[model samples]
Target: MKIVQISDTHLTAAGGPTEEGFRLLVRHLDEDVRPDLVVHSGDIQVLDPDDTADRVRSRELLDLISTPLLVVPGNHDVGMPGLNAWAGITVTDARVAAHVAVFGPDHWRHETDEAVLIGIDSELLGSGLQREADQWRWIEDTVADLPVRKPVLLFLHKPLWSATDEPVDHQVDVGPVARDRLLGLLERIDLRSVGCGHLHRYRQVRRDRAIEVWAPATAFLAAGEDSLPDGRQELGYVEYTVEGGEVTAQFRLVPGMPQITTDDVPSIAQAIEAMTALR
Candidate 1:
């Protein structure tokens, strides 16, 4: 089984083309590999409630994919305009439902040639949130004893923790306790790999227990200066090729594109600084 993952395309209504870079990658998949699934790991909306037309445009891109997907929302998709007013208007479930309407259900064990996929949405994992107890029950059931013929793989938008300094934009932030509860349950299952997004850059860490992660970003290679490519920012996706007890992962940039290698990435960052003249 082969799968492609794309994430964090902070798109807007103004530059409403096909998200040229995104289309390029999709085209390559359509013409060559043709993956069975393409899971988009959130941040689909551009963080504005008034951008209804743009949101609809974003969904248009979803319609172009021939493969099935498991999409979840990110903080940006939750309408980060006015914190107080956000509660009255934004419905994360409705946004997620739209994704499911295009992809698959909220969560499931998607039987693939290589593994059984377990999906969870951390966007709603908040304090004192027992209202979602039923959803948690469904996840526990889906991950229950499997056929033993497939290894288990988990997917989520925000990762369990941050391995770096960036707080607000990276890591799961306030989702630690909630995510731990979910992970503890998976510890009993026969798991192999876990994949995640939302950092906009790639970094992998192993828990020294049953699971290891493969973190890769599908968009935003914007490593201008601040985050050097060599040691800073890398924007790409992980191509997972699974075949009978063997899973190969590769962090390859979009075909024919030059990623922010150290010098270039830092230079780009410097350019941004120069534009702002904030020195």
Candidate 2:
């Protein structure tokens, strides 16, 4: 099976370079990289979780891809959990429901003859909401029942850990407590890879028996003050080839898409300013 992972699109209804980049990606997928499936890791919207138009537009645009697609919610899509959520837009049931209305379930499982693919809502990890607990239970049950020999590919918005061996930064990675809980549940499966977005960079690391792949943002690049450590801050996506219970991943970029920065777009800059000003 061939799967493509695209992340942190940050698209808007108003349309801009970011949307153009996504269109380029669609063209590439249709004309060049014809993968079996495409998984969008997150940040499907420009910024606001309450903007119905943004969500609708994002769904409409994503439908352009010819391959089967699965999407996981990002902080920008359903808001982050905990007190330090960006712009104080914490995750709520309403926000999650809104996302589900447009993007299907926040968590899903796709199984093929060769592998099992799972996507969970990273935004719900530490929220302490009832839905969070529900998702946890669902995840445990789903993974627990998987065939032990089937290679598992997990996808989410935030990464399980950071680039360095430092304390868990909730902003960049999953919360420590939730991470432990999730890690424990995943131990039963033949985990092959964990793919994520949110960092706006492309990186891959080996952890125990699994590979962690951070897919780069298709919308813009993170540079200078906004950059994260140890990852290539490029604009692209990831393609994975799964065969005989083994997975091989490669980073890919569309030829005609422009590599843009946050500063190059006023809306993105303003959104960042608003998020930072709250701190």
Clashes of each: 6, 0
Off by over 4 Å in 2: 164-170, 225-227
Kindly provide the TM-score of model 2 when superposed on the true structure, using C-alpha atoms.
0.96
Q: Cα lDDT of model 1 overall?
A: 0.57
lDDT of 1 by residue, 1-279 (tens): 787777776555544222555676667767776888877766665444345665776777766677776675555554221232222333355555555554455455677656777766655565123425656777777766665546776776666644344433323432557667777777666666666665566654555533444345544553333322222256666677677865555565768543432244343345335633531
Off by over 4 Å in 1: 16-18, 79-104, 127-131, 162-174, 209-211, 222-232, 257-279
Give a tens-digit lDDT track for model 2, residues 102-172. 99999999999889999999999889999999999999899879999889999999998754455443478
Best by lDDT: 2
How does each model score on lDDT?
0.57, 0.90
